[model samples]
Target: MNFSYSFPALRGIQAGREFYTVMCPLRLIPKIFLFDEEEIPAEHRAQRVMNRSRIPDITNYILENPKDYIFSSLTASVDGEMIFQEHSEELKDIGYLTISLDSKFLINDGQHRRAAIEEALKVFPELGEETISVVFFHDLGLVRSQQMFSDLNRHAVNTTSSIGILYDHRDQLSLITKALISDIPLLNRYTDREKVNLSKNSPKLFALNHIFNTNCRLLGKRKGEIISEQEKEFANQFWVLLCNTITEWQEVLNKKTSPRDLRVNSIVAHGVFLEAIGIIGYYLYFYHPDEWEKYVKKLKHIDWQRDNKEDWQGRAYSHTGRINKNNETVQLTANLIKKKIGLPLTEHEQKIEDKLKEASPLGT
Candidate 1:
């Protein structure tokens, strides 16, 4: 076999059933091995975690039929003395599944498999399995080994983050486009810098994606096509309007005596932004463009209860906060749209505004 690894260790230790040890300067090495399929040993096979069964029927399987699992010679090696000191000492007499190997001591593909085998052997003292079968890489380093581990485990039968999941399956243009479009509302509420943060790490992005993709169990429709043309158009317009709205919101947000009242951290804007998109696109689509623009600009410039970061936090958790004089001005704009376009508002929202108007005459 043409091995990419150099095993000078072979000269130091006899390559037989006994373990070998050698020493060399640190570098990189890669190698490959072929494994044979055979009947799993009774003791080893019983050790497999197949469902909830606690005891592996190892002795029975080994006694009844031992010819099914085949064992192969390990074609692994490491920098002789260094590996003996740093890595292989753990393997002293401990038998393991030698599946394959790659650069810098990369375990080819059997981490879980090896783990299960070890777990089984640990519980069963009769197996006498000491050394695990592992291939060796002469060339790869620690960083590359970590990256390889990530690649293998990412797809190895495990649950992962939605963003991580999204990134992996994002080769589909439709999915990527949907993710970008759906995250706008969240990106808007936080400052522009906040948007970047959301794009990279925020759950808001995932939440919006869930809502947009209708991935929600209660609200989403899974049977329909990925994204309908009407939905696409709605998404496009919604993004455009939200971007403008956020820009306007910031202009007002900065002018407040204390912008903390606005509760920028809350998801209120997500709901409001969603509602506004529906209202503007579906109901008030034909409104006078310039007049609408002027009103929006004016709304953006208005100072209100939303000026407080605490208020923004309250809004995040569904608290509308007190409608002081400053907030009433901003509330009026929202109320006017609700009345003029006949946009839908939940009873709770109407009550919130009513209370605000009562508390803050200036806003009314």
Candidate 2:
């Protein structure tokens, strides 16, 4: 047989199963790896039909930022024998693997990456030289192929958002969040980027998303949104003053109050409180810019002490009997804080406050 498509490969054995690893160039991928959508209806097909929509974003991400994106090796099952031609008689049987194009090759995983590499090659022809590792195994018919697909995905745990932001440098929000963590001592010391919810005993005062999202709100931006330099400076100023004004925050800064106790006993260390403060700060920023610092001093007056459950449970946690972070509770909190400091409430705020006032205040 004409072995014109042989690749220098490493031969390996796992669980008594023989597999071959080869680095396949981008240009040869489409020709060698066959994804049969038609085989899907036959139930004899090993791979599922490709989702056309997912390929474009992946291709675009690669093309837009060619320097940073990574595509892991593809796991494929060959329709015929993967014959590893021996190197020499004196050496072991390990040698180059000759895979033929004459037989079908089904991709058990990374079908999307294969499609994206093909698309990226069209846009950037130089990308054709780029190579992706391919792991080839014996033709495990349709049933085993489908099982392989399931087994591969079952073990894959998606990276969490905090971890994603921790590693990602491309998104503007992530960049700003990273900067804030670096510059703000409180955040740098007490933030948990890997978790969205800080545990009761966690030393963290805020989740990374909470800090990032609250900054978005303070700038009057949407979730996962970007902000300008002016808005960023304003948010920074707000944080500095808010921390300075809030005694608990400063206490944490001074080693006087443990973040764990503040988190367990009060709402000061929670996202809802930060969000509510962001909402209040929005009003001060817009209507009272000249008086912003003066109004910010009002944070000290907030009865953040959690033993005041009489006020907290009814206004913030009355619905579910726990910290409810929905818009309604957050608004009620914003209203309560605004009123405590004698800021005029909007009609919506007044209405929410009236409802909270009507509910029996939570018992201490």
Top-TM-score candidate index: 2
lDDT of each: 0.36, 0.80
**Stretch of 10 with least lDDT, candidate 1:** 24-33
Query: Counting only residues 3 or more apart in sequence or on different chains, how many pairs clash (N, Cα, C under 3 Å) in candidate 2?
Result: 0
Candidate 1: tens digits of C-alpha lDDT, residues 278-324: 33443233443334444333434323334444333222223354322
Question: Where does model 2 exceed 4 Å of error?
Answer: 2-4, 30-57, 87-95, 220-227, 279-291, 305-315, 318-320, 326-364
Residue-by-residue lDDT tens digits, candidate 2, 264-323: 778888888888888988898898888888888977877886678766776566545577
Q: List TM-scores for all candidates, in order.
A: 0.30, 0.78
lDDT of 1: 0.36
Residue 90 displacement (Å), model 1: 23
